[model samples]
Target: MNAESRDRLRVTVARSFDHVVMAMTLRGVTYLGEQRAPYNEEYDGNDLVAASHLIAWRGSEPVGVLRLRWFADFAKVERAAVLPTFRRHGVMRALMQEALRYSARRGYRQVLGHAQLNRVAYWRSHGFRVRPGRPSFMFSDYEYVEIEHPLERPANAITMDSDPLAIIRPDGDWDRPGPFDRSLRRAPRKQRRPEELA
Candidate 1:
């Protein structure tokens, strides 16, 4: 894609339900359902925040996605995907680079991810290191190895709470709790009785 089209590719925070559907569908097709929770679980915006769902849109249609989870010292990257038509054209790499740059800008000490066994070399080429230990998660039949990228400075972390390109802060304790937590705490608003409604 050209710079203009690439620049037009908007990455925005999305609701967890949409994200979950996308994630589950993509993972299921790729045989990574073992890594996913059941799809019937309800979710809310806060759940999306905790997961840091960044939906890549080409105009109005979402074509790619990536999720981020930030902690006090580090950020975790996961569930990255790009639609078939968008693959091999640097969409996934662009999303990752943006996420890494964002993490570095947010003051996170590092950015970490669990790469599928088949993608270990791909991650290695991007400067990630495999942690020497057993896998903590599984994607399809493959195990995932922890990989991390250390940041040189806290100032390099991405700050998503601001304008124009505003994003949900991965860190907890913003104006509101993140999407994932919201999902956990969400309760249906009670409807008013007829008398109360009147």
Candidate 2:
């Protein structure tokens, strides 16, 4: 990947069902097609709940994806995959950086991921360290090790003190007013009288 190609990469939160499917398609290509992971195991039920998906696009084509599952104290990064053609173009790095950035903005203290044993070095290269005292485990027929990255809370991190509108903004888009915020521009609806209803 040349510098110009790298400049063309854009990572964003998957904001709609279509965007979510695009992310999943990238994962399916890499995990199910390349690695032959079983359908059920790859598309576990957690995707639609307490999770956010990030999709990386090379210009107009979706090239990579990562999923973040929120927990009380931390966010877990999972199902990271990049198309084979885009493997050397730093798409995974972009996804991981965006995931960490989003997590920090949400005021999470740590981000966790399970790295396949062979890919431990790859995760370590991105500032994640193998969690000490955690034993190796196997899942989906592969050896895995727990890894975590510590995040410093940003000065503008979201909290109870944030504006209610900002708190309700879409994931990874806290800085902008959402559709619900825009709706506030309209006059409040008036209620009908009891006789009018009858």
Candidate 3:
């Protein structure tokens, strides 16, 4: 964005009906229309009722959008679509930072995204890491990598493998505990006292 447009950038949670439409409109244009992303694959059923959207606006015109869906152990951020004109202007960054804070405050342990393979560097720049052994997604023109952002890891949190799998799971969503949380429950090895051993 240019300096003037940068000053006008604003991001917010979709509060009203119109705001929701704006989010969808931006998504439709970028994902469905511009990239020609498969309509069926693009329109996952989680939108609207089960997800909340964040929209980046420049003086009332929506320019970027992303959706957040709650999972058992993390928040899944998906379908991030930004206007071609706004691609390098930090709009997505502003929206994602706010979403991360919001998810962390709501007691989520982490956030995950199915990021396009080519944009791996961009996502990494935002503190997202590709887990070891993660699956790669193949679409018409893009492959995806699962990226993660751990929120408030305790000192005792289990150390992830040098490479982890694509794990922010979708099966047991919202309320149900899922298989992906197994590693998180691993207890740190107990240290033995020298006196006891003797």
CA lDDT of every candidate: 0.64, 0.92, 0.77
The number of residue pairs in model 3 that clash at the backbone is 5
Q: How would you encode candidate 3's per-residue C-alpha lDDT over 20-112 as one tens digit per residue? A: 888888988997898887877777677866688888887757889989998878889988888998788898898888778767755678999
In angstroms, give how far residue 70 of model 3 lies from its true place.
0.7
Q: In candidate 3, which residue ranges exceed 4 Å CA deviation? A: 1-6, 153-198
Per-residue alpha-carbon lDDT of candidate 1 for residues 1-198, written as tens digits (9 for 90 to 100): 676775576565555576657654554443334345444332323344545666676665677877788677888987677777767766677777777766766667688888887898988877788876755686445677889887665532345534312245343223355665456577867788899877
Query: What TM-score fits each model?
Result: 0.59, 0.89, 0.70
By lDDT rank, best first, the candidates go: 2, 3, 1
Residue-level lDDT of model 2, residues 1-198, one tens digit each, is 666875699899999999999988888888899999999999999999999999998877888999999999999999988888888879999999999999999999999999999999989999999999999999899899999999999999999998888888886798888988999999989999999999
Query: Which has the better TM-score: candidate 1, or candidate 2?
Result: 2
Angstrom error of the Cα, residue 22, model 1: value is 7.8
lDDT of 2: 0.92
Better of 1 and 3 by TM-score: 3
- Give Cα distance to truth, residue 123, candidate 3, Å: 0.3
Candidate 2, pairs of clashing residues: none
